[model samples]
Target chain A: MIRIDQLIKRYGALMAINGIDLHVPAGELFAYLGPNGAGKTTTIRILTGLTKLSSGRAALNGHDIEKETLAAKRQCGLVPQNINLDSELTVSENLDIHGRLFCMKPVARKAKINELLTYVDLHERSKSLVKQLSGGMKRRVMVARALMHSPRILFLDEPTVGLDPNIRRRIWSLIKKIQQDGTTIFLTTHYIEEAEFLADRVAFLDKGRIVAMDSPIKLIAGLGNWAIDWLTDDGMQTAYFPSRTAARESATAKENGFTLRRVNLEDAFLSLTGKKVQ
Target chain B: MMHGIIAVYLREMLILKRRLKRQLSGMAISPLLYLIAFGYAMGDAVQFNGHTYLEFLIPGLVAMGSMTQSFSIASDINVARFYWCIFEEFQAAPISNFAYVTGEVLSGMTRALLAIIVILALGLPFGVVLYYGPLFWLAAILNSFVFASLAVALAMLVKSHADQSLLTNFVITPMAFLGGTFFPVDRLPMWAQKILFLLPLTHASKAIRAVALSEIPDWRAYLVLPVTGVLIFIFALRSVKHARD
Candidate 1:
């Protein structure tokens, strides 16, 4: 569980994270959707205690991140946005160090490392050096390393950023399995489909503010069931319709080529903020 | 806190163990060259303070080697910070700033101790045996502590890995050459001696060389090393906190 109240983070003249509030109940997979520099990473950084908050309060489970830093940090595991695994270290060694940092007992650390390696489908590659592994494998190792402490919550910041579609799907399944196993996941990503497919609830953050927050299906439903996309002189445009027949009729009225598709989480975000998630 | 320190130290030791062969060679090369070039070239031809030039140079080389090796921890820290992003993993973990700093400082000291061992072993072939008493080791450790702590503090402050190199060039290099490592600080002009005396390495060189040469070591040199080490250690802790900000 996580709680944030009127959280504001300012970097000199720039408002990296404007006033925002959020609460994620235990075992919920919450996706924070935003474009580049939308304060998604900033919010995650604040919550993880990597960066100090300029104002307001944030707590992990019940521990205040500022006042109870070690306790709050112990409550959550973060898979950072980048591939930060130690390249020179083996997969098992990396996980072993994380366990030690969290003060896990040697036997418990070894057992957890074994369990997580299997959980992430990396047991076979546990002896491999991180640098020797492929991108997807490295990402899996990072996931396993983060989970070594058995933290109550996991903060995944763009976990599948550079992976191919197939690998992304695999990571998505792993994420789904994690949520099913009762770990609360706080994910920040720019990929609309990732949020739609994996998150139990979604928050669309724009310019350091949350413009929309709801379940993916409900957010998409708010924009209707069907979407008609067509290229115009200005740029690409889209319109939503409650029925496929209505969407087809709208597409037929367009002179240029058009696409008729189901309304997705992106349409909802665009409709609310007038900006693309990418 | 102890667990955090051990965890951090263990990571460094693991890496060091993995690269022990190459690191051993690296630790040997510079001192080997100094011994052959300066030690053999001036073997018994020169004497300083009632000892052969080789005898004088071995302890000086030990002091310089320990200082350089201890300070080299910064480069490793910078690499973890910039390339590997391993430092961020520590930042996100439950480890306190004090624990992190202490762990890194100990690792640096470990490297320094290893380098000292290599230098002492290298000295054996030349029949250059000297006193390696507890006091000698205390001076060595205190000297390593000062530089290693300084290294951690500077590692946090530098913006890039390149900046870390610049710091070595400006800070460590000068201290290595002028800190009574090559010759007696007393032999230098009064003004130069005064300035070099300000260097912790200079006191370390004096204390270590005195003990190795079977003389009564100056108590002042022992006092300076730990006092400077503690101050730099506090600076390192504050730097880690500032880095998080």
Candidate 2:
């Protein structure tokens, strides 16, 4: 559903998104994991037509982002990191404006707004001003607003950032449901667990480059099935083992405080990038 | 593209409607004060182009109202860009830069028209009525267009809300005063006239006042406004494209 080839984006002397290639197949939930300033959002911005690429080519469902901007844009929906809904406008009005921008007919717009509001569990608050809603409610409204036109690909840039764990789980379910409905999702997140639970494939991006890309289970399995962490003079040292028995054996041999646990997606990301997801 | 422009324009209209009472209060107070302080205080002592001072002042106020209100859109754009982040939402959509600029410029012109109506209505209570013929409407629209387009371009260029306010203080406020809105440009010293003559509002006020008084306006003003509006509108499109990228 999305193709990026040798994409390069520069801001004066600094390259925000350097030569990166990616392919997101239709109906796949792809999570992009990175720390702060890791070019994740920049890549999403370039794909969604929010920022122009300095070099190379990107396409959405076969439409080139630069030459066929409108066509490419029409195929994608982006829920930005920040809540960009018009605060003074009602929830219905916000969705209505988005629908109208995409040239949805009035009857179609009304129906879609109702359906999306319901889909996001925001039907009751449709009449309320966006500013009156809670953070989670506002985020839901943002999601509904982005889906008003029903684009083929959805770009979610930290859709659950700053939300509580419960709310994050709700958003994750909503994202899962969106993917199940045959929409390709390209999600950028700092939450490794979120990616692990939701993404079919995860890519670790650091310093404007992708260091690792694979299924979360595969990536974690490739590192090890289990890990042992122990205090050391340097700081903290961790060793990975293929099984819990081996990890337990390693932990028993240690003479300091140690922890034995299953290897997770975060460990895979850290092993590749050497930087923890923040 | 048209749908996107209309959508954006409608959003602004809805906001304006909801804020009508506050907006009308703000729009009415200044023109009322101008009428009281300048019109009543002068008391027919100041005459221009063979008309009463109140008659002369009303059209100038209309011209100035359109200029200020239209240019005021920059503040709204700055708010949306920095505070609301709504501009980025549009950028991520299928809307074109030209469509976005057109929508904003139309909204600014609409605000200018509403301000003109408020000023004209205020003039009625003071027993000042003037011709609002085709020329008057044309000049008002073109005047609004020029300032609205300029506002869009400047809004894109400014980095912060503080910078936006600074621009209004240094650029817009001076033009509001010296754009032949209150007096004839020729009445100023030759050097001042040369400087003020370069402003689009000078031509707008001259043209609007001519129509209000039923005199044949200088054809040069009629040419200057539409030409300036078109050019500034193109520049505004470029600014929107640059800012979005």
Candidate 3:
């Protein structure tokens, strides 16, 4: 569980997170969607105790991030946006260090390392140095490393960035499994489809503000069930219709050829903020 | 807090253990060259304080080696911060700033001790035996603490690896050469001696060299090392906090 109230983060003259409020109940998979520099990462950073908040209050499972930093940090595991696993260390060694940092007992640490390595399907590669692993393998190791201490909440910041679609799907399944195992997941990602497929609830953030927040299906439904996309002199344009027949009718009315497709989470985001998730 | 310190230290020790062979060779090369080039070349031709030049140079080399090797932890910290992003991982963890600083400072001191051991072993082939009493080790540890703490502080402040290198060139290199390591600070001009005396390594060199020669060292040198070490350690803690912010 996490709670944030009127959270404001300012870097000199620029606002990184502007007066946002959020509460994620335990065991929910929450996706934060935004384009580059849209404050998604900033919020995650603030929650995980990596960066201090400029103003307002944030708590992790009832521990204040500022006052009870260690306790708050102990409640959450963060898979950072960057590939930060120690390259010179083995995959298991990376997880071992994380376990140690959280003060896990040696026996518990070893067992958990083995369990998580297996969970991520990298048990055979545990002895391999992180640098020797492929990108997908490294990402899996990061996931396993983050889960070593078995924190109740997980913060995944762009966990599948730069991975191939197949690998991304694998990571998505892993994330789904993590949520099913009763861990609350707070995710920030640029992939709209990722949010749609994995997130129980989605928040679209833009320019340091949340423009909309709801279930992905509900957000899409609110924007209508079908969409007609056409290329115009001005650029690509899209219109949404409640029914496929209405969408087809709208497509036929177009001056040029058009495309008819189901309205997706990205369309909901674009309809609200007039910007691509990215 | 203790657990946090042990965990951080354990990570460093694991890495050090993995690269022990490379690190040992690196530790030996510089001291060996100094001993052969300066010790054999001078070879009792120069004497100071009723000792052969080789004898005098060994302790000086120990002092300098401790300073350089201890301060070298900064490069490792910079590599972790800039390349591996390991420091960020530590920041995200539950470790307190004090625990992180203590763990890193201890690792740096360990490296300094290992380097000092290599230098002493290298001195044995030349048949230069000296007292390595508790006082001598105290001075060595205190010296390492001062430089290692300074290293952590500067590593946090530097924006990039190049900036860290610039710091070494400007700060550690000059101290290594002029801090009574190669020759007596007293032999220098009065003004130069006064400036070098301000350096913690100069006091460390004086204290360590005196202990090795079985002489009562100036108490002020012992006092200066820990006082400076504690101050720099506190600064390192603040730097870590500032970095987190």
Candidate 4:
């Protein structure tokens, strides 16, 4: 549903996104994993038409973002990294305005707002001011507001960055539900577990370049089935093994105070970039 | 585009509805104080264009009130951009830049009109009355348009709330006093009149005061306002686009 070719974004002497390319098919959940300032947000902003590209061609469901901005924008809904609902407006009013911006009819807009509020389980707070909502409740409202227009693709940029673990899981389920309903989702995050649990195809971005891209199982399997960690004079060191028995055999607690565990997506990123996801 | 502009305008109206009491009180207090302090002090002593001081002050108040109230939209824009981050909501939506600008400018104009109504209503009990014809409305709307458009441009250019306040203190407050709202430009020294003549509000006051007194206003004043309004509106559009970059 989204296609980007040779995207290059520059800020004077610095290039934010340096010649990256991606394609997310319809109904696929694509996770873009990166550390801070790794061009993840900039890529999303370019795809959503909020930032202009220095040199690239991006299309949303066949509509060029630069040449056909309104059509391209209409194809996707965005939940930004921050909560941006109007504080004084009621929950319903916030959804109502989004509907209006998309030119939904009044009758249809009301119906859609009602449906989304219920979908996100915010129906009880429909009339409450956004400022009165808790952090989790506010995040749910943002989700509902983004879905008001029923766009084909949803771009969630760090949708659960600062939320509690429980709230983050709730949002994870909501994202899953959105994908199950046949809408393509492009999610960006620095949380390794979020990408591992949610994304169908994950891409690792470091310094404005894609270093790795594959399914969670494939990426982890390529590295190893288990990992052993121990502290050294330089820092922490980890070794990957193909089997649990092999991993246990490699970790000698008496020598270096080692620990053995299953390999995860973070190990893949660490192996490729030589840096932690955090 | 029209629907998107109306959507934005309706949102502003909803906010206006919620704060109606506070806004009405605010709009009422200042103009009433100006009338009481200036009117009773120079009731019979001053004669402007052969009318009593209160009569002359009422229309000038209308001009000044409209300018200030209309330009006050900058505060709202700043709050949206800085605190709420609501501009990103519009940016991600399918709304056009022109639609957003037109919507905000019209909302500002509506606020100015409401302030004009309050001043006019306040004028009645004091027995201060004047003629309000089509020309009067034309002048009022054009005056509101000029300031509202300028407010949008300045709102986009400023970085912080402190910067916004600095703009109000240095630009808007100075224009309010010297724009022929409190005294006639002709009454100022020749050098001051020459500088004040360059102010768009000066032409607005000249045209509004003339029409309020039932005189045929200088056509040049009418021409200057709409032309200036269009130019500023264009500038506001460009400013908004640049801000997005």
Candidate 5:
């Protein structure tokens, strides 16, 4: 569904996205994870044809975004981070105008707006002015706005930020449903758990570089902690470890018993980046 | 291109409509307030070519409205586009470069023309003659579009809303006032009037004043519309195309 090769973006002497190569297969939920200023947003902008890539190639279904931009963009929907919307316009009108932009016929446009509103659970609020709605409602409306054209792929840049946990979970569920309906979702998020739970494949970007790319479980198990936690009867129990060979022969093994448990993404993240998760 | 252009334009108008109570009031009243202050108050004191001061000032005010209102389009859009980030949504969509630029200019022109009409309507009772009514209106539309196109060109080159605001106040207002809108260019020295004629607003004001005063107007008035329109259109297209990848 997406291909990026040796993409490089530079501002004067600073590199925003450097030599990044990526492939997102059709119908896959791909999560792009990166720290702040890691060029994830820049990459998203470039792919959407909003910003120019300094050098390299990006194609959507083999249509180059730079050459056949309109056709390329027609294949993708982008939900931006800032929740850009027409606050004065009613929900229906906003969707209506966006649908019109896609050259959808009036009758079809009305039906599509209804379908999208229902898909986003915003049918009841369609008559209300966008400003009158809550923040989470506005975000959902934006999601519906992106889906108006029914693009084969959806790109969300930080879909959940500044929203409460409940809203975040709701959005996550909706995203899962979208993927199930066979739309490819490419998202960039700061929330590691979001990537962990939703992404079929995760790409870790740090400082304009992709450091790690793998499945969550394999990523965690590959870099093991093998932890066991228990409340000892005496409460002063110690833990033991083996480096190699019959390390149990050490006196530490005889002195204490430790439980073993599987390591998770946080462990792998810490191991790979050496930065503790907040 | 047309669909996307009009979609964004209609979308912007919808936003304005949502804030209708405020948008309608703000745009409608500012010109009337000017008419009352400059028209009624000074109509008794000022005289130009021996006409009522209100009548003389009304045309200038109309011209001023066109130029200043054009800036308002760019200014408000700059706020929504850069500060509020509404423009990025258009960027991320399938909207073409021409459509995006045209949509923006159209929104500005629409608002500017509406303001001018409201001002004209409000002045109808105050001996605001519409001699050559259609001609005057046609000229006003042409001039409004010219200023709007110029504004879009400037807006494309701007980096921030604050910078655009500073330039608008410093550049747009002075050009409107000195473009022979306030008084006749004949009042200026020979060299100064010649300099003023070089400005598109001068011809714009001439067209308005000629129609308002029931005069025939100079040939320059006829040329200003199409020439200025083409120049601004060409320059704006080049700017937008250069910025587009």
Candidate 6:
């Protein structure tokens, strides 16, 4: 569980994370969605105690991050935006070092490493150096490293930025499995589809502020708008939606050949941010 | 508190073998060349504190090696921020500040030791006298540990790679040279002695050189080691703590 209240972060004259509140309940797959420079990473950095908060309070499982950093940090595993791993070390060695950071016993760490390597399908590469691996392999290794400590809460900042689509999908499925295992999952992504497919609830952050927060379906429904489309010899004509019902009613009154569809995250994102979701 | 430090220590020693080999060629070998040319070529002129010039220079070279080594290991902290891509791992881990600082100190000590051995081995027959054998090595390690902590603290104080390198060139290099690696501190002007007293490398070289030369070993040199060690350790600890949380 996590609670963030009125968090304010400033850099010179610019406010990075303006006064904002956020809550994540146990066993939830929560997605933090924002574009570049939307303060998503800053918020997660504060939670992990890697960066100092300018003001306000953040708690992890009832322990304030600033005051009880060790306790808070012990319960969380962070997979940074970039693969933050030791390239020179073997897969098992990577997990070993991470486990030791939390003071995990050698015997316990060995077992954890094996279990994680297997879970991420990297057991065969246990003795291989990270630099010898491909991009997808490295991502899996990073995931395995995070799970080595058996953290109760996992914060993944763009865990699938440049991976192949197959690997990204595999990662999402693994994330779902992790949530099913009862670890609270907090993630940030620029990919709307990722948030939609994996997130139980997604918070859309724009310019350091959360403009909307809800499940994907609910968020799209909240948009209350829809688009009707007709493919002609030239191109597809897409209509705007402030009302799905109205859009549907219009579809009934259209040129009699248009396809009417329910509004989805892509549509909702465009409606909310005034730009097509990339 | 020391577990994280041990993890870092192990990682550096085991995974950085290639880098160590490279550094031995660069920092260790470059100075050993001086020991070679000067030890045999200029056998006539270089003497200090009552010993052959080569004898005086070899131990001094050992001290110099340790100082540069300890300082270079400190540079890895900055490297972690830039390329190794693992700085955030340490930053986010729940380890005590003591562990990180200790790891840096130990790595620096290791590098210093590496450089010292190679330089000593290369300068063996040139008449560089090493009097205290095992104890000399012990003092060398301790001296390096203290200097390493000081170097790491200062390295962390800077931000970018260029800035860190400039500091190493301008600050660490000057400290190594003026701290009496090539000459006795007594020979310097009395005013400069005041400044040398303020630098850890001065005491480090004094302590290490005393042992390498096998003299009775100055009690002043012995007293300076632990005091300077604790001071630098505290400064490093505070800086890491402030940076982390």
**Model 5 chain B poorest ten-residue lDDT run:** B236-245
Model 2: CA > 4 A from native: A253-256
Choose the strongest candidate by TM-score: 1
Residue-wise C-alpha lDDT for candidate 5, range B60-175, written one tens digit per residue: 77777877776677776677767777777777667777787788778777877877877778888786775647778777777877877777777777888789978888888788
TM-score of chain B of each: 0.99, 0.98, 0.99, 0.98, 0.90, 0.90
Instruction: List, residue by residue over A1-278, the lDDT tens digit for candidate 2.
Output: 89999999999999888899999999999999999899999999999888989999999999999999999999999999988999999999999999988999999999999899999998999999988999999999998988999999999999999999999999999999999999999999999889999999999998888888999989898888999999988988989999999889879977887998889988988888786888
The Cα error of candidate 1 at residue A83, in Å, is 1.5
Please write out the lDDT profile of model 4 over residues B1-245, one tens digit for every residue. Answer: 98889888988888888889999898889999999999867788999769998888888888988899999999999999888889888888888889999999999999999999999999999887799999998999999999999999999989988899999999888988889888888988999999988899999988898899888998988899999999999999998888876
Name the weakest run of 10 consecutive residues (lDDT summed) in model 3 chain B.
B41-50
TM-score of each: 0.99, 0.97, 0.98, 0.97, 0.90, 0.91
Per-prediction DockQ comes to 0.87, 0.82, 0.81, 0.81, 0.61, 0.57
Output candidate 4 Cα RMSD.
1.4
Lowest summed lDDT across 10 adjacent residues in model 1 chain B is found at B41-50
Residue B92 of candidate 4: its Cα lDDT?
85
Clashing pairs in 4: none
Tens digits of per-residue lDDT for model 2 on B1-245? Answer: 79989998999998998899998898899889989998889997887767888898888899999999999999999999999899988898788888899999999999999999999999998988789999999999999999999999999988899999999999988988888877788888999988888999999998999999988888898899989999999999888888976
Relative to the unseen true structure, what is the C-alpha lDDT of residue A264 in candidate 2, on a scale of 0 to 100?
91
Per-model root-mean-square deviation over C-alphas = 1.0, 1.4, 1.2, 1.4, 4.4, 3.4
- What lDDT is obtained when candidate 4 is compared to the true structure? 0.91
User: Residue pairs in steric clash, candidate 1?
Assistant: none
- Please give the distance, in angstroms, between residue A261's alpha carbon in candidate 2 and its true position after superposition: 2.3
Model 3 / residue A16 / CA error / Å: 0.4
Give per-residue CA lDDT, model 1, range A77-102, as digits (tens). 99998899888889999999999999
In angstroms, the error of model 4 at B227 is 0.7
